[model samples]
Target: MAVKPNQTTILLILRIFQSLFAVLVLALSSFVAHWYNTTTVVSSPSQINFLIFIAIFSILSVTSLVILPRVFSNRAVANPYILLGIEIKNVLFWFAGWVALAVFLSRLLFCRGSVCHAAQADVAFAAMAWICWAGSAGIAAVGVFKGVKKSSGNNVEVPSGGVKPEAVEKEAV
Candidate 1:
């Protein structure tokens, strides 16, 4: 049987995922920074990096997709739309920035002394980087879509066919 999640439970899940992803992103960045700084000594990072990257990149995207629309609609606290019309746009932009940051950091970590890709490097790193980048872009795009949809005030649904003026006036109260 399917069980419904309570409101606080849902927010807790979202915050947990965001926190986990943020930690992973920061940790990966530090590791990458150190790895490239000392690439001449260490051949490659352990397989654990690959696993962590995959876990983080995939999990981080859920909040961008799930939490944003609710916030816009005032289903969640701190409605971005209620306070400022531009808040949604700002959030979307930041989402893109996060993705770009992750991609740039991952590329630097793997390529280590060049802006170019290396054929000799581990293919998993390359794949993870691209997927994370593309996924992040997708997430940001979804936020943009939400911002547009909500800003236009399009959530008010019409009945299956149409509502007559008398019925609408009666329902308005």
Candidate 2:
């Protein structure tokens, strides 16, 4: 029998894929930085700047996807408002990823033929990362609008301080 996927399962899968893409970008950027720096004495200043942005974006994207899913999935303490807030944050992070990836790609494109070889691998990886970030951000925005469900099993009851509602009603009569 095929198990049906739920919200938690879907969120986990997306987060995993996002993290994987982030890792790929991280690795490819690092390789580009190391290779281009050691092989050539004169390096494009923008190349290092692009590498730094990619590295920072990769780390933050991975961290947010890994941790925020857990926070959003825990039905035990799941507050719809809080989940909405967290999802908003996730959307912002992924949007930042989009900006960083765009800058990195533009920098790679404007470089010369020789530099393009090293950046080719980064281009492919960054494209994947860009797609992943876009999807993740869109999903988060949807979540914020859809709202999270509260647990059905637990209900709370309040005890009167000294008198019950019925008693208070009688006293006012």
Candidate 3:
């Protein structure tokens, strides 16, 4: 369910710009992480590689955020599945994925490179991840709900000068 190119140009541009910004953020974070990697650890896990770990996750985040969305938006793809469409559904799914990635990254940051003490957090990562994942799924799921039926059962309500469904029904009767 890809949208025509003519209709999606603006959306595509906006998405590209967003991707660029995200990648830039990851790049800056990577620089910081690399700097962190050069420092000595004072804890039991003297062999810790926190910077490398963050760098890997940053790469993964950038891939999921930028590359996946572009792939989903491209019209050349032949997948016709409604759930995987490039319309509102795909956008929502992409948005959710981005949000989840952000939450995960934030949790990583909260750990502050102390792998052994990461589990001590009370309400940062645990609750945030669930909230992000569920919210995303709900938004994309609405598209599925819309596809279930073309229209709602309610009749259209028109203004005084407009054609009225009730009057039309009376005339037909």
What TM-score, over all chains together, does every model reach? 0.32, 0.55, 0.31
Ten-residue segment with the worst summed lDDT in candidate 2? 156-165
Q: Write out the backbone clash pairs for model 1.
A: none
lDDT of 2: 0.54
- TM-score winner, 1 or 2: 2
Q: What is the lDDT of residue 99 in candidate 2?
A: 59
- Per-residue alpha-carbon lDDT of candidate 3 for residues 78-126, written as tens digits (9 for 90 to 100): 2223323433333343344444444545655355544323322311332
lDDT of each: 0.42, 0.54, 0.38
Tens-digit lDDT string for candidate 1 (1-173)? 99998543544554454445445544554455456457556543433244345445444444454455444433544233332232333334334434544464466545434312222222333344344344434443444344432212235532222223445576798
RMSD of each: 11.6, 11.4, 13.9
Error of 3 at 31 (Å): 1.0
lDDT of 3 at 52: 27
RMSD of 1: 11.6
Best by TM-score: 2
Model 2 residue 118 distance off true place after TM-score fit, in angstroms: 4.0
lDDT of model 2 at residue 97?
A: 48
